[model samples]
Target: MSDLVTLGQRIRHFRTAAGLTLDQLGDRVGVAGSQLSLMENGRREPRVTLLTSIATELGVTLAELLDTTPPTPRAALEIELERAQRSPHYTGLGLPVVRAGRSMPDDVLESLVGLHRALLERERQAIATPEEARRANTAQRLHMRTLDNYLPDIEELAQQVVRESGHTSGALTHREVGLMAQKLGFELVYVNDLPHSARSVTDLDNGRIYLPPASIPGGHGLRSMALQAIAHRLLGHEVPTSYAEFLRQRLEINYFAAACLMPREQSVAFLSQAKADRNIAVEDFRDAFGVTHEAAALRFTNLATSHLDLTVHFLRVGNDGAVYKAYENDGLRLPVDVTGSTEGQLVCRKWSSRAAFARTNRTTEYYQYTDTPEGTFWESTQIGTSASDEFSITVGVPFADSKWFRGRDTANRHRSTCPDPSCCKRPDGDLAGRWRGKVWTSAKLHAHILSPLPSGTFPGVDDLELYRFLETHAADTEG
Candidate 1:
């Protein structure tokens, strides 16, 4: 309801407290009882002169009468009921308007309000399906392509943050990450019992960021996650209301984290010198930054087109050959299903990403040149193991651009006629014909493809558990 309703309610409250009838107040204020009733019901706006007069008669200040709060608990319930009835969902139900009268018990009004709230929460909790998520990802990827996957504004922010953390050279230490957190008015707290749904929790109420110990394994390390969480606050991110916003925040945090590990100005200088020397290598980049092979290769893509005059492609494909992530500005065609999403699509077995898996010596990065319908491209793949599975991180450029990279002369060549079944999807004609009827093997299904994302404030996070953990920690702090 509007301020007029609360004004009238306050006026009525004072008048009743003073034991005056509406007509009596009208006489005292020079207004009609019918008009006072209209104003009280929130159906009419009172004039400034009338409002002043009413406040005077009620023996209350103008500010007191203009308070936006409903004057009483019953009034609050009444207002909520009125709003609930006016809502589209409620009106669409074709139910008669619920008039909360003086005779209506507060319990019934409270129940009605609770029901409406539940309805709204259910609508909010409806997580995006995989198809919707894919569509958002697809749109986000296309938008990233428009900018060549480089966000200069975020890069600048990362540079400022790193410099503030007292990082002048070499890898960013864990202590530096803590110092960074302190500068942001947060303490880094390592705990073993964090909510299973949370990789890291930023307890803004208590000025703490909770994360796993430094032993956070795999290519996505402890520092990266810490930086990414800090980036959220730095970027002014809110809880996303849509899949698109969620994906955008994820992309931004990652970009910020990468920029922090690989600062733009310094990284560009190193890459420029390497380009001039004709010996650019991912291993050297990884060593110089103290980041994982995957992180270094991925960071290269971020700076390649913008700083080095090179276009590149990157992929993180699982041992199962399903592509988890793919980005390219080099016109390398990747397989896609009907949804136009490269994620979860099978990589051609002949490509370096899949072929690197079969190599007996997996100690070092694998390099190869592939001839495809698009063009000849040179790719380097390194194996990285996560808790869930082993995946290959492949970074590649067109044949001409490969001359500047260190792994150009490996002599491992491949040809791929992707999107054609005969290329990699099917076996040889004779072998297929011989085994067609004899073999009846069951196909292994990937269950994740059919599942919807978990429902919560952040996807899959249990909000109640998070709140309870915070409460426990807050109590400890108070103690």
Candidate 2:
């Protein structure tokens, strides 16, 4: 039927838009790749079982398929997902989609499941094309290095924009920065709705970044989202997939923004002066370069860790993706499977409260505490900083790698626990001495530490020195 053919085309279009391929659809629907191709090409009308499989795989509903048109509402995505669960794909694979009659509205849950299924399908398809996987892997590996190579110019331009804008509350809206990029002929397409979270993918050949919204939450996540978006925009394009990787990418963006704000000569001169003083406050830094606190912190930390030879690490409860710790060695080595709070709240405990501790024992360890901001905190004893009521500290050493560490596979050893509720509250406090472990983050890790500037103050310390110190020293001094 022409209608069925048309529907197949629509499904194909949606699949591509969702960043999937035919083989992915097949796996999700539990059909072979060739079978999916036949269905898509309209060689055979999909049976009800196959139709349901296709719907679930695409995260659509049976009604959506029967109607032969894509649904516009978010609710449609849920129905499609439900239909997929009911399809023969699950049965074919001996996997049964749960039938929950008493559960709450299944839309969001179903949609999420559908997304995961689609991703699984895509991964399966990707494995078949070893060459493609290799190419993608190669591309990801080079993306950061190549982007790093071009950062000087990006920093300089960002600086100029800040100076020209003259608005520095340490917060710049995403819309505002996007408009600026647009003025410069860079188009902004937000993928995630978060304001401060944005990314810039580049058409590398044209030297242009296509700014996409970093998350899908929309305006609610606008502020932090915007900073990330602009940071990526500053980089030419092609971002690392995770937060740690993004941090490395942002570091490069910060460098680029700095270079743009202060040309190579001016930046050198500015750094020479600041390096002498070691007192770049967020406001002063913001004034000097047109960027937000978040952006400034990212850049400042990168500069300290990369060029100043200082170690900086940041950890915050919900902002683990924003965490960083600088180190001189390759990275922090800890046991793969060691658990408790060190993996979860190490950042919040250290930076948020500035905790202090003496090594309790030689073995791996962990701890947690709360303070009022005016009392004696953990760091006060060891580092000699004045005590604050708001401070708390927990320390942990790593354990040796083991089978549990390997987590059902020899190659993929576990790094940290899932950050779900009920996870340990203070990971750094429990330092286990044995395992070979590196720090955990959502960003890429760098091996070297920049040398301290001449000033007693760390060369790249920002207005927020207290937090910067914790970020820089946490990993090395933890054990």
Candidate 3:
């Protein structure tokens, strides 16, 4: 059912329950019976002063009269059916909508609502196919590239949250995040045994967000999980019915959480100064915000082009030269499959993203200048480990703009002709001759190649576990 505030429904409920007819109530409120009927039908919005007079006559406050909830379950179903009929899905059917009146049976109303729900679900195209995921990611990436990956609306919302919570500078404290959650009408509860398939579970009925205690390996910190949970509601997200919607929401929440951490105004001012000093670096950004290096690097991409007039690219590549995630508009050619997807595709071995993985000292950031077929680019990479494997996060800019960066003068350099076999993919003449047609290797396949997304209203979550967890907590709350 739609969450629209139904003042008309509430008013109708109260008027009928008070044992008054439209004419009787209208007379007491000094309005015509026809006008009151129109107001109750939601055809005409009543003035606030009029609502006050009506409330007094009904022996209730204006606040109660304007409550968002429908007066009854039947009323809620009526509203949902009304909305569904008006929607384009029903309109496209070119059939006359049956008016839901007091005489309509509950079961009939239910059947129609269920059918409408199914129609909407079918419209989502069931984002379960392999191609759908790649298509969704490709579409979102292209859209992000067009906007330079900055979302000012989300930034504004985060700023309002920060301002209202009394956060000024430095890393956003856990206390401040709690305050923000409170302002959004939620409580963060740390718990053990969050389903293995879940990171966090939001109990909207109880206004509680349940998170696992002790940070999980390769996952973000406590604050990030909390903020992301809050973001799903703050951004007014619905249960995503499609893969595109799911990925978009994921991107948005991550962006919003990062903005809440660094904030746009302060982060830009900090980057502006760094650019002025010609020493812009991701490590410094990470230190200043006390965020993960990957977070800081990703955050920089959000502000780099939009705020600083610098075109940049970011890549998260596995140690095995697989491209995990990437963003670029600065002429760095990334490898992609036919679906315009870079995920799981291989980056050139000679590129800094892969080269940094081979470095002996993994503690320090690896800086390199790679001369690609397109142009010269300078990049800074940091190698990090997770339970799965080692990976690298890199941010790069064109050679000319590299002067404003800290590692512009790095002695490490590489020349490459990626997409050409001889650059790196081809074996040396001696080795090729010795091993030609002599090796037969079987490949170990990743699970994703065969599996579709986890089946549920929300992907990857076990609905039964989520329900039992909520039920247990609800019982405790009642106790």
Best by TM-score: 3
Residues 317-343 of candidate 2: C-alpha lDDT, one tens digit per residue: 222212122111212321111321122
Q: What ranking emerges by TM-score with the best candidate at the front?
A: 3, 1, 2
Q: Judged by lDDT against the true structure, how good is candidate 1?
A: 0.86
lDDT of 3 by residue, 271-370 (tens): 9999999989999999898789999999999999999999999999887787778999888988888888887788888889999988999988899999
Name the weakest run of 10 consecutive residues (lDDT summed) in model 1. Answer: 444-453
Least well predicted 10-residue stretch by lDDT in candidate 3: 444-453
Ranking by lDDT: 3, 1, 2
How much lDDT does each candidate structure score? 0.86, 0.40, 0.86
- What lDDT would candidate 2 get against the real structure? 0.40
lDDT of 3 at 474: 82
C-alpha lDDT (0 to 100) for residue 21 of candidate 2: 78
lDDT of 2 at 183: 55
Inter-residue clash pairs, candidate 1 = none
Q: For residues 1-479, what per-residue lDDT tens digits would candidate 1 score against the true structure?
A: 44555666677777787788889988988989988888877778888898888888878888888888888987877777776677666787899987777788889989988988787567447646778777877888878988998999999999999999889887888888889889889998878889987888999988989888766654347889889889999999987756778889989998999899888988999999999999888888999989988889889999999999999999999899998888999999988878788888899998999999998888888999999999999999998888788899999999999999998889899999988888988889899898888867887665555466677878668889988888888887788
RMSD of each: 7.2, 20.9, 4.4
TM-score of each: 0.77, 0.30, 0.82
